[model samples]
Target: MKNDFEEKMADIMIGEAVTALLDEGVAIGWAVLTERLRLAIENETDENRVRAGLRAIEEVRREMHTRASERTGLPRVEDRSAHKLH
Candidate 1:
């Protein structure tokens, strides 16, 4: 059986996917929310909200890393070129 941490991480990964799905023109009836997410990425004027969104995104990414480690039994490659000869 998967460890609790691994299971939580997998759930977070799925949540992140759902968030991304909603981000791509899902029309959640709140443009501000989406704009905030965009502004978070683009570093908009609202630093506090931007920071919050960034934190949320970062948390999801961390969870994804954990889940990937569990599912793939590997870490993500920072440089795929290392796998190939240039």
Candidate 2:
């Protein structure tokens, strides 16, 4: 029962909403990862354990960057803090 313009508008609105939700989810995920890395660094006493934790954190970060780049069709930016929502 909808006209072509109305259908197109609905699609556009849906796309925007989906993009917003994805962005928020990514922000929350990054915040959680950052907190975990901070805690690991702060509480760990052993150098090896701290190094391992840092490696794990870095791996997760790289994976997230790759996924985001693939999704957006844009190259990954070096300054992740600039993209932080907080």
Candidate 3:
């Protein structure tokens, strides 16, 4: 019975971790989308498309920043070295 309970608890913890990871991934994806959208809007000749894309990108960027802030409490450290110029 004790082993069974432990296994169940472990499963629950693992599930929670997976969910958090997925949320973090989604946040990161939004950041990437924002950058790509910005590039596309800059190169776009159609004024309507440019305006719409800018609006969309701004929304996505806001969401990404919010999600990123939410995930900041997670147990992880930033790898500053990876972003440093050589």
Scored by TM-score, the top model is 2
What order do candidates take by lDDT, descending? Answer: 2, 3, 1
Please report, in order, the local distance difference test score of every candidate based on alpha carbons: 0.52, 0.59, 0.56
Output the better candidate (2/3) by TM-score. Answer: 2
Q: Give me the overall lDDT of model 2.
A: 0.59
Scored by Cα lDDT, where does model 3 land? 0.56
The 10-residue segment with the lowest total lDDT in model 3: 73-82
Write down the TM-score of every candidate.
Answer: 0.39, 0.49, 0.45
Q: Over the stretch 1-86, how does candidate 1's per-residue lDDT look in tens digits?
A: 43454455444444554576577866442343444445445845654444545554555555556677678866555444566787
**Model 2: which ten-residue window has the lowest total lDDT?**
9-18
Ranking by TM-score: 2, 3, 1
What is the C-alpha lDDT profile of model 2 across 32-51, one tens digit per residue? 66455556567878765555
Candidate 1: TM-score?
0.39
How much does candidate 2 score in TM-score?
Answer: 0.49
